[model samples]
Target: MIELQFSPEVANARATGSPLVALESTIITHGMPYPQNVETARAVEAEIRAAGAVPATIAVIDGQILVGLTEDQLEALGQTTDVAKLSRADLAVCVASGGTGATTVAATMIVAHLAGIRVFATGGIGGVHRGWETSLDISADLLELAQTPVTVVAAGAKAILDIPATLEVLETNGVPVIAVGQDDMPAFWSRSSGLRAPLRLDTGAEIARAADTRLALGLPGGQLVANPIPEDAEIPRDVIEPVIAEALSLAQTQGVSGKDVTPFLLDRVFHATEGASLAANIALVLNNARLGAAIAIATTT
Candidate 1:
């Protein structure tokens, strides 16, 4: 059996049959700098708690799968360097090697299902890279969603990805892409990606029902809840599009490829936008937390 550790808060929630939302830890270890990353993490957790759900932040440390982290663990993880960004490809290896790591969307979904938690909140899900035709650089997250039953709430695919190709993969895999509150799928920092969503859900209850219906039908995969960045926090598609292009160009010129491409692009965009991108990322994460909490509540009840 795999070793699993649950924080006190999460333990109590499970004991009492309370709603719980799963959160990925890469946002803390790999998304940004120390204090800000932990602060944003705490804030997102607070949002879930305030919305009447418990937050279980998943990670791996010293061969143990942590379904939720304690305050000290969170603080230490935020300050730790050289943490592996784990996905389906290396999650078990990291555990067996007794290495420290932060869970990516795919890893989080796997852990969430193992912990009996049905909903996960994230900043964005990784998907097909821009040149996927050649590189075949698709994220393991897409396949994870198609295999796990956990409902994921996110701002949508990272803005640096090819949204069209990502959508095609999701459709081909029979994953439902439900845009919340709009017909257009969200594009990470932007509210609209200029692509029509496969389905639009107006409320958390609607999303919850869809997830439940999928299970009732014995569907093999989960649903993607494309929650948009709040209007007040969005950078707007028009403004962010050019910035994304510049970042992509810089990545290409720098010869950044494979897993390194995303962080490189995101960092370049963060600099180009004078930190507005980070602010938008934080906002969208909190927004997703709220929706994930709502879905958790709906799913459990």
Candidate 2:
């Protein structure tokens, strides 16, 4: 049997049958710099707690899959260099080989299910990358959502992806994309994507009800709750579109492709926007955390 470990807080939460939300660790190790990453991780966890749920930040450390992390562990993971960027393909390998790694969305969902936690919150989901026709590079997050039973709350697919194609793939996979409080799907940094969402939910209770209904009807997969960024915090689509185009152009000129494309474009956009994009990212993540916690509470009760 695979030995899984939980931090003291998470263990207690699980024992008492309290609501819990799983968080991915890639934002701490791979998405940002040391102190800010650590700070953001703590803030997101606190958001969940304040909303009446426990936070379980998933990671693989020294062959153990951690369902939650202490402050020191969080700090150590943020400061450590060259930690593996783990997804569905390598999660088991990291555990078996005693490797240290941060869980991406796909890996996080798997771990969350194993821990019996049914909800997760993140800044955004990975999706069909631009130029996927030739490169055929798609994120495992899409497929994971189609199979994993956990409910994921996010702003939406990362703004850097081809949103329409991502929606098409989700539809093809029979995954439901439900926008919260809006008719249009959300872009990561923006409140609306201009494309109609497959469904719209007005409240966390409604989202929780949908999840329960899916299980009652024997649905095969989980749902994607596309929570929009807070209106005051958004960068607005009109302002961000040209910026994204410019960033993508620069990334191609720099010969950045495959996994490197996302980080490269994000960095360029961060610089171009004078750090507004990062601020927007942080806001959306916290917003999702609050909503995720509410859904977890409702689902468990």
Candidate 3:
């Protein structure tokens, strides 16, 4: 049997049949630095609770899958070093090996489904990398969404990815990419990706209804709720485009590839942008969390 543990709050929420939203732990362990990471995580959980849903931040710690973490655990995770970045390919292996790790979007979706939580909030999803035609380095997140029965709320795919190819993959997989409250698809730190979204949802209730309808129709995959970052927090596409290109070029020059590409590029971009990217990232995550809670509440009701 898969070993799983739930904190008292999540356990009570489950017992009461209350709305619950799943959160990925990579944001805390790998996305940002300490103190700020822990603070942002707590703020996100509080946002969910304030919106009438329980937040379950999923992670694997010492062979056990933790569906929810206590405050101390969150702080500890932020301070811990060398935590494995657990994705669909290695999530089970991490569990079997009794390793400590942070769950990525795909891994979190799998665990959320197993725990009966249908709604998840995240900063952004990974997708087809730039120059994917040559590398074939598509993220497992797309495939996971194609089959998992959990709705994911995010700003959209990471801006560093090939947006057009990512959309095509989602279309081919029959996954609905619904842009929330907008006609344009969102870029992770920016509000517009320069392409139209496959679908658009105006409210949390509409998103919830679509998810329910899909299940009723026996659809195999989850919905991608492309919630836009708040206009006030967005960095604007034009402003960040050249910055991203510069960061990508730097990555190539520095020979950053595979798992190291993202973090390396992100660090370079963060420095190039004078910390604006990180600020925007935190803002979008909180925005997604609030919407995720609303959708979860609608789903449960």
Candidate 4:
């Protein structure tokens, strides 16, 4: 048996048939430290609400699919330790064992789609790790986007990955990577990756229309909307590139690989930039939430 618990806010949205955007809980559980993580989660949810949509921050708690978490739930999840980081392979096991888990981008999409939600907002989509051919350390997020029909709005793959390779894999899988308001892809904390985007969509309506067209044509997967970080909040490619290089070097030195690589690099970069990275992360996620709400509203009409 499975249970679905909704926060009061989300329950009302469901009853009203209002647009709701799915948010991943990993940012709270794994992205930052306690109060800040909880604070950021609420802010992101508020951004969605203020933009005229509901936010369903998905997680699995004691075998239940928690579609929306309350303030207390967010605090507990943020402060709790040993929560499993879930993906497609482990999602069922976590549920079966009655374990608490944070939903990654892939896992969140699966949960949201099952709940009939069509859009998700997240900080970034994971991708092929640098030097991936040896370790084959690709993030399940890419595969999820290739198979799931839930539209994802993100700042782009975390710049910690091999951006070009990530783009190639998405292309090979026929996933539409649309850069919102720019010709180039946004590099998570940075405004540009210095690589041309495969497609460009100016407004949330265009992105939503594209998603609807895909379903109408029997397309199998969803869209990757690469919404850019605001200029004032961006770290700028030039200034941030060296910091990333340093972080990657430290990761290699410490033998960090596979699932640990991203978080390790992110922490290192956060320290290197003196907290600039974390600020940019918060900015991009809030921005994506705004755009995601717009897309969710469009899907209903």
lDDT scores in order:
0.93, 0.92, 0.93, 0.93
Residues 207-300, model 2: lDDT tens digits: 8989888888898778899999999999999999899999988877888887688888888899999999999999999999999999999894
Candidate 4 lands at a TM-score of 0.98
Cα lDDT for residue 258, candidate 3: 83
Candidate 3 runs further than 4 Å off: none
lDDT for each residue of candidate 4 in 132-206, tens digit (9 for 90 to 100):
888889889998999999999999999989999999999999999999999999999988999999999999999
TM-score each candidate: 0.98, 0.98, 0.99, 0.98
Which residue pairs collide in model 1, if any? Answer: none
lDDT of 3 at 151: 98
**Residue runs of model 1 more than 4 Å from their true location after superposition:** none
What's the ranking of the predictions by lDDT, best on top? Answer: 1, 3, 4, 2
lDDT at residue 196 of model 3 (Cα atoms): 96
lDDT of 2 at 279: 95
Q: What tens digits encode model 3's per-residue C-alpha lDDT throughout 193-260? A: 99999999899999999999999999998989999999999999999999999998888788788888
- Per-residue lDDT for 255 in model 3? 78
